[model samples]
Target: MQTPRPKTRRTFIKNAALGLTAASVLPRTFAKESPQPDMSLSYQDLPQWRGFNFLDFFVPNPAHARVKTPEEHFKWMRDWGFDFVRIPMAYPYFLDIDYSKDITPEEVYKFSEEKIAHVDRIVEAANKYGLHVSLNLHRAPGYCINAGFQEPYNLWKDQDALDAFCHHWELWAKRYKGISPDLISFDLLNEPSLREDMNDQHGKREAVPAETYHRVAKAAVDRIRSIAPNHLIVADGNSGGHVAVPELADLKIGQSCRGYWPFNISHHKAPWVYKDPTGLPPPKWPDGPEANREALIKFYQPWFDLKESGVGVHCGECGCYKETPHDVFLSWFGDVLSVLAERGIGFGLWEMTGDFGFLNSGRSDVDYEDWYGYKLDRKLLNLLQSV
Candidate 1:
């Protein structure tokens, strides 16, 4: 039997907050403002922005259980020594369309202001807490790495999709026109891999053709910069944020990489990624290309090379699931994060407050601390802060 989506069970009301007052809707349990973000670091260079990915707008449907994040998540992230939050979003969430209907291209461009304020609630909250926010289109008008929904057009192969992609970026740019780049940046897309079938999540994937990625990303970047001249734009590496794209280096944009290098270690039994998750061996640290520190360094040499060429790079997503052994997870993660930190590259762990986060991760081995009914992995938190 299939598990049910939490849309019916989540009873917490989403607050429609405005301006700095967004913080007022925070959980009554935690009463403290996030420190103002240090403007000392420039966002264009992609400062060592280490933090978690917020999912409030990632899927953006009640059926998908996505809603606005409480300001407390931001405050605690700030108090915990993390400085960034990457929000992977679905554009349609802000649109005035029925989620159950087959969406037309025309309807795709239209969005609801009231719905968008929910998004503003997140950005404004992140800003209020002094955290740098990077907005990414996990589900663009025509493309996304993971599968669940179908698009009428293919972003990688169709001009119509490309147009929609650029149009959305233009909308976002206009929406936050005067926002400082230091506080928020726009990540053009999540992971740009070519798929034979858009709805098949477990099928063999191909890296997006470099030339095609170059064209699509350039178009979106140009469109965004035209509106918000100082906005920093970053693109995920081809092939699931692993392979660096020199094809886009010439563009004045940042490139993003990932921490899930070896699926064995990072996604040992992720049900979506593996057909029979239980058949796989329990994950071990320093296996295969990660057999040693030097081997791991060699794996990311391409990313470092990209940075050397003056293109800013950051690991946009990295983390193990609740199923991975805690000790092994940290042991492997420590090396992964250290490697990225050494070269001045920052990272955003896959998620926060869910399967792959430091809160409510549901790991059997962790000595979880109680944070207002939420479980906190103090060991993992300490490991991340050490770097």
Candidate 2:
């Protein structure tokens, strides 16, 4: 049976703090005025923000080894020395009814309710553990960058879809206003790809204009900030961190930043997506560290050079696929950690336990104890400890 969505009246309280005071209000348990840094603070000023990506929530299923409650996730994250959790969510998953073909009004309302509850539980859990959390709209309410999402990227063209997207963020700002200083960041959207002039050989007609995408993103960002001031708002650069918004750059949203990292080696045999499908032979441990480090640094230089306000850099998602050799994966991580250490940039591993997770998701025959036992990966943990 599908899990029922949390009840709104029982779960959400109306007076939650948001807007400009979002980062200002702290829980009674923590100091209220302790020079708490905003997103705009220099990376050096706020040095304790080690983080990890919390998957499974968006891609929930019985087949996945599901953790029963939010508390379970927090306990594991805290024990592993993670200070922050980036919860990536897909709005489509929460729809009351399937609308993969055509969305309906009823599905929209149900989705909004489900999303609010999902955010509420996650933020509450983060606060319970005193961990910072960044809410990421991984797949916007109606669309995604992945091929699995309905094709032609209709989000840019459909008015209802765009409105539903903006409404979700506004509601979030209201629902999670004064939860905790630890709950201070919002990722506007995941990687959004748009092309202005493209060939459609079958139709013999040019596709729709690319300006629509720019307009949609700009509107969404503006709407979110207007209602939820003082929160660190992150805008994803185009795929591979290729695009930037001068207007957003000027906002200096302090915490608004970009993400980039080496995916080729890390995702060599990744099943979901890959740069090269023939699978570049996996690297050997300890020896491949230098090359991996070079790739990460080179890929991140553009964002590093941006001098705009509130524009910090983060490697939001990076990890080797589970299918790759364990020793090689560990080596790649070691190199990445070393580079992040030198640059003072923060990063969140792609997931906790799945195809790209640090822990085995039990789908494969790989022995977690023998390959990534706690002791064997101590150096990697220590690197996170340094953060």
Candidate 3:
């Protein structure tokens, strides 16, 4: 085994910009108050699952392979009143393979016992902490939104990729068969591509249609349902969770969206995004050059429509980078959380302690302390707690 290297800030940013790429509940009391349609999944549907993504040792790195999130951490989260955790995992890390060699059905489909046990520990911790866990494949078989990483086959077009993808999920479904859906949920893929890159011989940039994405997603959903019919399936919206796929409305699964709207504010100084916010007007709360209440709501219309149709909605990933001002973060977060709460949507902050995180994110401006075995970002932590 190789020494696992800690994931760097750049890598974290890439995942954040992407996984930051990708809710619920209520009813009954409204009968006397008014005829309010439950626009989101009930607390019972998701158990008010709300917290952060724990990526201390996600995937793709060999260094952190033996790492395990301390069970105490989950207990701390529960003590803090958080009941949800989204764990973004990478499939490649758990497979026994030589990247130098051509991937075969045997290699891609096989699981490493060590990695499998690591994930099992995570699930056990979540159950003990009473947290609802959303297991996500940050880097799936053929689709990884992070640029520069290439897959030999296109997940949407290649049969092998699709088969391997579904098989990987089937294994998970089989492994955690008895785990109740109320405790563990499956997040099919991290930010799926906006459009499938069509490398035509003419050197043109053609793209696949949106409906095609639905087909790809449904295939995975169908496979998982075949074995784990009761497991809750959560599918992320396309294009970094910026848009919703209406085709998935009838799929009977939860919908996920992001909170990095009006990127200038949420992703200020983010190296991954193309637009330069160097001279862009500073973002303000309720009214800014970028991201205001109306703008945020407008961007969420499609997702809102999905919720109105009685589908579950969750903001799987959402937050501003550490460079973002504290006040600005609070303002943006306040509005975002308010809207989510109003719509009865459940959300998980981008992360817990790095990059787009509340603690130990390397923000020089904020005061911090070693609390509960982690650097605590008091201001940000307070803001999140208030919500």
Candidate 4:
């Protein structure tokens, strides 16, 4: 990635102007002013929250190859009118150094002071920028969404894995106990999409039903609340945050939903999403907005019920791949954002930079310019700002 340019006064003004333009044409659903919904979860009772996931350069252990430091990232996000940052992290960075082929429960449960300090640095930066930090475990002990890969333990089934996972959360809760929930929150796992048919390397089907996820998540929540009772915990609704987990409603934790409905449009030709896009038909918005809306309403009905029951509902990950036509992407994005905002729900775009970000997502059809040392996707940025 190229070094991002410094944000200058001229750039800020230009961006602000673009945002104002978008605000003028924003869908009516999000245009109306409404009070934010009250939350039953005491820790999340804050103002309307909006931000993007910052996953750039967050790879496996010793992650220092990013284009910007945590402080720089948070500062930029805050200055751009964002109030939240979802930091999706891989766990290897926090694991013990002595581990080899076989990772023990000790290794899984242990956390290096250096790694904890690294996270602390991010949290401190978030505070400096007045941005809430949602620390997320994209890859956990025994399961991940990535296909054709397996972890040492299956978090949904193995007691050791579940215990280790809970212990890790416990450690985090203890570390950030005194911090206000306004400053920091924990997103226990990311995109828990397990397939009942898929087999792990050891030939075991690592299938996790909704009940299993509820159990593990409840246990983790219990562990966290044991110390930091007010800690805000979020669990990814299964299948990329699109599927609802009603079983988790009783847990009294927040649920992170996905906005990537009609995946062919959101993930169009994205390599990670499909091995072959040749067969996919082109997508158009408003072509079936009603159907799309119905799908979203149905998929999110349970979550809405949970919200009605007082649980906090949030769309933690939602964005279309850059390769999709810009107009189509915007049309789809507008609908999703409108739905979320109308419901007084909080959301964050999948990423702030790189493959699925607001800036420099490598869309071939779009023109770009350097802003803050990164290629600025002005239109997309404006659309995000408008909502």
Candidate 5:
């Protein structure tokens, strides 16, 4: 992945910009009552399961297939208070295929046993550590938000794509059939947004029409239950996990929400979201140029209502990039966590050990803790543990 290139930025200009930038912060209770992030949530309305995401298949290719997480991380997670781990996958990464050319639909169904054994190892090891594992397909059969390859069909509009989507889930349902639901769950897709095409990394993505989304989600859910009746399943919210999909509420599955509200802050200088974050005002806590806690409260009301309506809710992904000021990021994230916790919701940080993770975050201002060879962000870790 390309390193984020956030330009040297200033806070909203001092004099002229001061008056317009101030916004009320959430109550101090927001941070004091921190919520834990988890993916074992929103499924079967289980207790909030706390943990972090591991991005082995996030942007995999033939050369870097199956970058498994260190087993010690699972041991450490168990040592810590967290009880969950979400592993986002790229479907192609586990398949037997020739990467030199576009993959045929026939090849999509093919799996490589050696590559799949690594997944078995991960799930079994995490379970042994007593962490509930949520395996999600960040890159699916025919669509991906940060897509890298071209697919022959469109997931939202084509039967073939939906077939392959359900087939992959069916494969998992069989592999881990009869496992206790408390130990494992399958998040249907990373974030479902209707795109004009399958391969454009930067393309306009509107919500999949409610009917279309229901059809796709139900189809996948049906297939999973057919083989493994007790497999827990969670579907992401429509339009990049920001809005709840009423069409799916009847499906009796958990739904996910994102923590990147007031995008200017959570994704501060993220290149995939911002082509250039140069000269943009650095985000400020409580109220930045784009939003405040009031906005955040209003933004998640729909999700809260959905949870009230009996759909399990979880923040599948949340965290600031290394670019945001550490203090500012912490204050805002504290509110985000607290608010979700108040609603009995769970969350998952974007990752465990990368730019957005607990170790080697590359944040220049952090006071590092030398935990073995890892540059541990004890402040962030403490904040997460505070909830």
Candidate 6:
């Protein structure tokens, strides 16, 4: 249900310009016009459903798992106007086997049972809330995008690591066989890196090649489908949402599609990756909506047309860091919502609470209030509902 590309780039450019002006500057007609599209699909097809990440499984214990029950989380999301949640998990975290550095065969079997149970809990919770979920392997058995995790495992070279990775997916497929299609999908991996000794051959730290990623991604997809034929599989784009278009153009998979999240906004001011930290400011809420719309268009246009005939394209993650001003965050989100409404793309935020989340992950019950206070960002939520 993808909307046809805007009438022309010129129309988009003009509308985009108007969008940048203060919301009041724009003619009331634009806002009054019905936000609904001619076609209908779940929030997944509405473009505005782009949402937040629920990263309890990846971050280490205490911090990783959200204290709020899935029911509480989903209810908050619904009230906040989000349509989906992206959950990232590490293979080793749930498994009994210590896939941490070195592991034995017996440990692998033990880990398998644990991993299965954990995934089942997540899927069941997501379904309970009527929210779509994307399960991503944030840290594979041996590899991770971050160097800290990569050193000990040497995941790329270890054969055992790769086998454990494959085995985990096979188990996951079997465990969630009957999960509802609307409630969940599988993301093969988080950000897959292509660094040689922590740096790419180009000397630039980039994601692994599309071919290598696709190879493993396909394997996982095949295995998962064998067990749960209906689960939608999502493949991530290479480095920073830069899809190797040609590489993906030739790839064909049934009941599966690909997704991407360029780091421009969400990772802005992120200390872990960005050196300056302050260079990329969080999006401003007061910024005119059109300016935000153009940014969204600029970021997504390159990969927009990549949606295959039957497959869908989802912007799996996007959000400004919590450090960014709340107004800035709201402005950016408003613009994103407008464009997504027009384009009908699916999306999710980087996190729910914590560093980049909507809720304060540090507190037990939305305790620490930002300038925005305990109340959710109502303006942004209203705009999302409008879309």
Best by TM-score: 1
Candidate 3: RMSD to truth: 12.0
Per-candidate count of clashing residue pairs (backbone under 3 Å): 1, 9, 12, 6, 3, 21
TM-score of 4: 0.80
The parts of candidate 3 lying over 4 Å away from their true place are 1-47, 64-67, 99-106, 195-208, 274-283, 286-290
TM-scores, in order shown?
0.87, 0.71, 0.80, 0.80, 0.87, 0.70
Mind sharing the TM-score for model 5?
A: 0.87
lDDT per residue for candidate 6 within 1-387, as digits (tens), equals 987764753354334433332232222121122232333232223233456777667643323455544566677676666768777876546544333455443343344343345555655666566777777887766666654433334445555555556666766655454455556667776656566654222334476666666666666767776776655666666663445333543334311212322344445556666667655654544346444456567666655455423335566765566565555555566666556546556566566656655455332233243433443443444544565
Per lDDT, the best of the predicted structures is 1
**What tens digits encode model 2's per-residue C-alpha lDDT throughout 1-387?**
999987563123222212322332222223232233453334322333567777645652222324634477677678877777887776655544454454453344343343345556666677678777878877675555544444222566666567667766776665555543345677777666543321221121222233654567667777866765556666666543344444355444323233324455565556555445683665554455545556666755565565223356665666666565666666667666666556666677766655666455442434445443431233344545664
Question: Which whole-number lDDT from 0 to 100 does residue 251 have in model 4?
Answer: 76
lDDT of 4 by residue, 1-387 (tens): 999999874355445434433322221221222232233235233335789887632554464436545478678888789897888876666654453355554455445555556666666777777888888887676766654433666676678677667756666776676666666788998887665422332233233587888888888889888876765788887765676666787777787888887777888988765767787777887665455666666656776776777777788888988788988898778878877777778788888887678677888877887986788888888888888
- lDDT at position 322, candidate 3: 74
Where is model 4 more than 4 Å wrong at Cα? 1-47, 56-58, 63-70, 98-106, 147-149, 196-207, 289-291
- If the candidates were sorted by their TM-score against the true structure, best first, what order would they fall in? 1, 5, 4, 3, 2, 6
Comparing 1 with 5 on TM-score, the higher-scoring candidate is: 1
- Which stretches of candidate 1 lie above 4 Å from their native place? 1-44, 288-290
Candidate 5 stretches greater than 4 Å from native: 1-44, 60-62, 288-290
Q: After best superposition, candidate 4 residue 156: deviation in angstroms?
A: 1.2
Q: What's the distance in Å from true for residue 354, model 2?
A: 2.6
Question: What lDDT is obtained when candidate 4 is compared to the true structure?
Answer: 0.70
Model 6, which residues run further than 4 Å from truth?
Answer: 1-50, 60-70, 79-81, 97-109, 112-116, 150-159, 197-204, 242-246, 249-265, 275-296, 308-310, 361-375
Q: Residue by residue across 1-387, what tens digits does model 5's lDDT show?
A: 999766432221222222321221111111122132333333547567778998776664647653568889999988978988898888888776888788877667667656666677788778888888898989888888875787867889877788779877877766665456677888999888988865776786688899988999999999988875666788998887788886797888888889987788888888877888898798898875446677778889998888887878888898889999999999998888888888888888998787888788999999999987999999999888877
